[model samples]
Target: MNRLALLAAASALVLPVALSAQSPADPIFSPAAVRAHVEFLADDLLAGRDTGSEGHEIAARYVASQFDGLGLKPAGDAGANGVSWFQRIGFQKTEFGQTPATLTVSGAGEAKRFTHAGDVLVGLNAAEPHLDVTAPLVFVGYGLENKRLGLDDYAGLDVKGKIVVTLRGYPKGLPSEEGAHLSATKGKIAEAHGAIGMLSFGTLQSMKARPWARMVQMADEPDFTWVSPEGVPFEAAPGLRASAALNDSAAQALFAGAPTTIAAIRKTADKAGGKPKGFALKTSVTIRADSVSQRVTSPNVVAILPGSDPKLKDEYVVLSAHLDHIGVSPAKAGDPADKDRINNGALDNGAGIATMLEVARAMAQSPDKPRRSIIFLASTGEEKGLLGADYYARHPSVPIKQIVGNVDLDMPLLLYPFTDVIAFGANHSTLGPIVAKAVAPMGVKLSPDPMPQETIFVRSDHYMFVKQGVPAVFLATGYANGGEKAWGDFLGGAYHHPGDDMNQKIDWDAGARFAQANYRITRAMADGDTPPLWFAQDFFGDLFAPDAPKAPK
Candidate 1:
């Protein structure tokens, strides 16, 4: 057995004895209850619950009905009825037009051309349908400029009016949250450097995990972003003429006559404590893009259970899960009899919403009430770049300061009898200890993130809350008790695919246990006198909300 499995086995021996002494009251979490909800949400009738689609509306109404049945009050958009259970989120969708894009690199007495959507993928997030740029190319390492960390890829580079070529992420050994921040803002950094265009290539690790073909397939789909009612695009980066991601071959062509190859630069970036340097590429490139845009609205289902304590009642704890999925794939021939075209998302998020519903039911029915109000939010458009959560965070139904903490559920991968879980963002706040305490009596271990390089913390709905200065935790089944292989196989085979249907094997009991653990964590936070607080010197807290108060030393 692997080391993680051995550790899990060793822990399992002592956990039952420890848990047997403090079991909670009779079964509030039922596997049958969770499965029932999943069956309905993942049913084919819902048409995969695409954002802004009728299927998504059906799912939202279902969640609203559950909250109503549990006696939770509406806490969504203010309406003629004072408040409704549907918070409307407006979005603008952009689709790249089918104009054959070309990237031509010419220098060193040689030239190469790459076809868009194949050898490369290009798009503009702006509303304008067309953009064209011809400029000199310069390598900028990872294009991260963080003065505090003494890392600046553009320290001595002259990239103004040129195209900046960079890798997908920051160098190794940097804090994951910091790296995530740098990577996210790289485009802005390029634009700030007066670069007219940008070209990025995936790191070897990223490319291996998600192949170019899969990325190309998804790139063909429309991109959506939350927008204002006046139809103004939100925070669109200015001065970027064009942007594109190059395939491996296309990227390697940029360094044909340079002293260091792309491979060498990647090697340097991947090394422990290594920092790649920047240099001008011995090439010139031209890019052109075409796109179209439209507007749509989606609903975020929100409900509230008022707290019993007068002093703490105004504070709120959010239980969040996305209700949207990728929906049906574009129809094609040769699909297998069992292979439905719908990306049912039974595991991707039907399971998560089911867990959230069960948690809501348990909390609403409990005789002992929490001190803080609990908001059960079934967010829309998560698959479309966390639109619902982002909108809610920016335009909260309640006072933003009152929303103290968030617990997000998404794609838990309950394919095995998991004895441990990895709670993303747990270590950044006092929520870590609360999670530890809550899971102890359930014979479950709280494991550190096994794949920090993936930056899982910033890739989900909880990150929306984190960005708004809320302390949050996103829980997932961990790679313990022989679950590593299970998770890997699932991601490789079913993730975001039509295979994520109800036909896949799932440990319903594990789902129930997972919900129970989340319930305990939420209950502890609600009943506690103080809200969840950020740890002192946390990278995310300091970067996103420097003025927010920190936890007691």
Candidate 2:
């Protein structure tokens, strides 16, 4: 390709035409290699690559080997037994110690025990394996305690050593990031109030977005938390001993003899500035929690490509993809999909990891090395609430301050010929234009997040980096050119199911294109003069990176 060419036009205008240059991914990508990586990782022998399982360990080593073969430097923890490519993470898995964990509510000479899941769903007690608690129930509205927002549902309530009932989500209207942060911190709030237990029921708004049946379907799944170095799980919330999610029926049962009915509470919550007050309920719930926990370790396969420029070499850019998936579908009869037990996350993340590996290969081998260092983090435990990325962000091998940006690749829908890609959180930072530039050469436009209501900005691994004040974006194919239906179908059917295997119609060329686009983005972020920065006064930037640099508005 010519860097510059001149053509004489009919109107006597001499125009300089710039020929199409090779994409960063095209020169280094192999469709066959991409397919082969997914094949090996998604194989039945890997058993769905569950975190802390032997299969995920094998998957981590496989990624490390790929890095080693690509000549990338080891960038993990230095350990005596394990190699430096492995950042061994500690995890605790909890399963039901005794099934049919019962909840009995009694008050005012009336007792009701909801045994079926239709009324309530009992969660595994990951903090304490064996637990039994009978505490007075108090309705604390939404259980929020933010004084700055002038919202304090626990102001006049005495919930010390008692069970506090709350709504599932924050109020209907709040800033997206703040509301998301508040919604995720309900347990800590309960613990801070000296509450012994908590019960959360869905609100009308929340249930409309996500149905109750979906929650019950996943009630039997195990719970996991990352254990700290001291062997205690972070934020185990010791004071909050037992918890349960109630359906409408169970919520109504709790207010059986109380001052206000659950129906009235729901109705009040629906109106603007109309909220239920914190009040002592006439009921007491006896919760029996019997669960078992075990400590296990998994690794984040970390590797780096050294930078070329001396000054910028100290700065770093990260590329991340989760290597773990939900191990296997629980055995269920009469379903042919369940007959194949293994939940081969070929797209859920097998494809994402494969893309990262190829991008790492390209970056490491490219003659035009990037100015800033590039770290390829094949993370684990993403299926379990982005634990691995959180650990990496909080305890990075590299200096956290030097990590300029992160690009997360997770579950790129590869079933269609996508003309545009959505980079979640891109608009919040300088990465927005950078992303547009990177994918433009591939004839792919950068699209806005189609489903903002999903709050997908904080759902994936990159959001962990964002919380650490690093500018980050989660890149994936957008809903265009048959992508809408494809995404809907895959998420509805094969997502985390056994059907996401190599048997699907995976467009390898699309995979190659996606990998190439990411490579260009990583390259641009690494070699560009200015490090990525939060857009001026962006919500996430102001929330997480207030002291960090910001790009001009």
Candidate 3:
């Protein structure tokens, strides 16, 4: 009877300790706190938080203050770097206002006037007015220049000092056979040919069938970028414009009285059957752009949790999340009243920021401190071309060689009651094995990338670290075959839209559990002695030396 009583006492003693370990991480991720931050960030008061805008300044300051309150060390020296954790990036913001743009073809019947902000686009092609081109027009099929394909769009034509109108992507299929044969990289060839202005035809019949067309094309609104194709930095290149869908239709109308449609002409070229005939339609286009240059400040909020082990503490594990969004879109396209002006970006990234915040707190309070430094980075300007993360990768507060893993969070949705986390780039790094080993008992399946062509591995801020030889993981909710509509409903509604508001729809309890999971996973990595390495056959294997040690099979 006495021994039985002792056994019962032992059982009672362990129960409280076990329950404490498995208890919910609610204290770390208070719904009130998460909602407060999300609501403030998504609020219209920030005025769409465009980079270099007043709203952007307010957001940056708020983030920096949070980092300060967290007692983070100044990652960048203020006087030496002329920036706080708040890194100031240099960029030119050009404002193009709508005025009247007149286009008159000498041979065409009438002069057409396109009002600024309505029917036409105007922007500075270069630093000066010398980029203005008033020349004859030449239509180039896809603007591809490749010797391997035995076809150069600029082959029998001189585009110098002329306006070159080019079609969009080449037809699908292999380089061999009747399929369209063109270099995958063709943007450089367009600029090299001395085409004063190149207008990309966006609306083709095939493009309409693409599932991602809706995401890429904002209806009725023209998206403009001075960005050149990769490998072709025209340092002094002239104006580059992506024509509206209407512009493509207008170009097609030019061959109206011809015997063949543009589509048929391209098909003929693909088969190498004959030279598709070209017609000269009197074409004249004028673009005026107002360019504004300004100096702006955004921040990368970083807090470090010093490790228990002295040696390993010098090395680090980074947790990153972009704190910027597309800001806001103009109202002319849809819902003129709201003006598409508020891009609250609740899911695109607001969730990511909140995750990092909770993870920081939870890991800090854990019973066992990590062996290596844990860095929580709130990066800025990810929407503006991954500028903040790129800068952090180049100018790291910690030694680049010492950073073992980069855990970058972007999109986080409600967790499935019984499913694995979807980690892209898992197979791309040596850290994958460690992660796999940790989640094994959790029933979390390590998945190889199902959508490789999307190049999602290289899309987020994590790519910046991976490119620099740091092993990284970009985690998102696992994909379920039956959840298409639910996925679409969540993403399509709030993604870069004004309706992305903070509401009860978000599963805060699940979000907190996910954050706890992240904290545990990262802690497991940081507390270990072995640092993760670049995986073999991961495309970036060359980033490590050829003789480098490989991850265990």
| Local distance difference test values of all predictions, in order | 0.83, 0.83, 0.57
From the highest TM-score down, the ranking of the candidates is: 1, 2, 3
- Sort by lDDT, best first: 2, 1, 3
Distance from true location, Cα of 222 in model 3, Å = 11
Clashing pairs in 1: none
lDDT of 2 at 56: 94
- Residue 22 lDDT in model 3? 37
Candidate 1 regions with alpha-carbon error over 4 angstroms: 1-27, 107-111, 336-339
Residues 1-553 of candidate 3 have per-residue lDDT tens digits of: 0132232123113211111223353234454455445555656667666665676666666666666666565565357554466655544333332433333233344444443333233333325423334666667766665444454566677766666665555533322211221322344465677666655443233345343345335322322222221312223333343222224344454334445566686565455323333333356555444333334456566667787898888889998988777776755545557354677776667777777876775675567677888877877777765767877776687788778788888967652332456576777666677666655554555565544434466678887787677888887666553234445676657667766666427765556555655766787689777787666544455543344455743
Candidate 2 residue-wise lDDT, 483-530, digit = tens = 989988998999978899988999977777788788889989998999
Cα distance off (Å), candidate 1, residue 528: 1.0
- Candidate 3 has a TM-score of 0.70
TM-score of 2: 0.91
CA shift of 284, model 1, Å: 2.7
Best candidate per TM-score, number?
Answer: 1
How does candidate 1 fare on TM-score? 0.92
